[model samples]
Target: MSHKKALEAFYHKLRNLRGNTRFVGGSLILFSGDFRQTLLVIPRSTPTDELNPYLNSSVLWRHLHKLTLKTNMRVQQQRDASAGNFAKQLMDIGNEWIQIDESSNVSPCHQTSVRSLKA
Candidate 1:
């Protein structure tokens, strides 16, 4: 099916499931490089009789905001863990670069030649 059709079907399924209590505690997470750019594509076509759940001011949008707030709080509580992970990643990258630089054999003769060329 087409992209629009698939999204509509997904939203329809969600609407139907929304009334059912068995599917409680479900969540949807959307990540974008630029939220404004992503929002610009909402309701892809012109204003229609039907509303898209993905658009701003929709029920899902409100839920997303709530989720974002909760996530931010949890992240704040784990600031030390986040910093540790960031430092680990930085060290890994630095070690990889060091290995690469060491592996590339540049002889002393080559260094002397480069220095002489500068003179």
Candidate 2:
């Protein structure tokens, strides 16, 4: 099916489901790859300004913003977990290096040379 027809069918299905559920508080998450680029081709008969759904005032964008607000909480949680994991990895690697450094039997002269080379 054509892009336009597909979008229409999707919205129709969404509307039907929403109507059946009587769920007014939910958000719809739709993904189109680089929507700005795809929009140009998807709504072939419409003008660019009207077809571009990402604009802040557009109906689709408003729904997306609501959905994004809900997802932002989860995103923050994931980000925090990822940052903690990264910090733990760094600390573990640093401790390994410290152990290696302490066990190595390098003379003061060798240490100075290594430091100088690093600099």
Candidate 3:
């Protein structure tokens, strides 16, 4: 994730280079990456401190609109329903949209995949 200052710097540079008064010289900036994902990993820093450099901390963040992607293109290309389910599960965990309780019993998947993963 880019720091807000870095984004602002590029924004101003782009605006100046294009010779337009509009933001980013009215050029559509397609900012990728999921903002909903994990916060910036900081060693020996508090959560508040970590957020200080995040893109959303900038004043420009309010003006930008967010668009969500509805489909997993990789899963679609692979033509695998199981892959879709796996991707959904991973995304759910990453987004904190679902919770799975840790149990003592090991799943058959874990038992089977461990060997394959080691190989």
- In candidate 2, what are the lDDT values of residues 19-112, reduced to their tens digit? 6532222534555442324444444356755554444434443444332221335445667877766656655664564345556676665443
For 1-119, candidate 1 gives per-residue lDDT tens digits of 12334444556676577764322225354533322232234454764423343345344344443322213344456778876666556556645643456668776754433345664
Give the poorly placed runs of model 1, Cα more than 4 Å off. 1-25, 38-54, 66-119
Off by over 4 Å in 2: 1-8, 18-30, 38-58, 66-119
Every model's TM-score: 0.24, 0.26, 0.69
Clashing pairs in 3: none
Clashes of each: 0, 0, 0
Question: Candidates' lDDT values, in order?
Answer: 0.46, 0.48, 0.85
After the best TM-score superposition of candidate 3, give how far the Cα of residue 63 lies from its true spot, in angstroms: 1.3
Candidate 3 stretches greater than 4 Å from native: 99-119
Compose the digit string of candidate 3's lDDT tens values, residues 76-111.
Answer: 999988999999998898779986668755667644
Error of 3 at 56 (Å): 1.7
lDDT of 1: 0.46
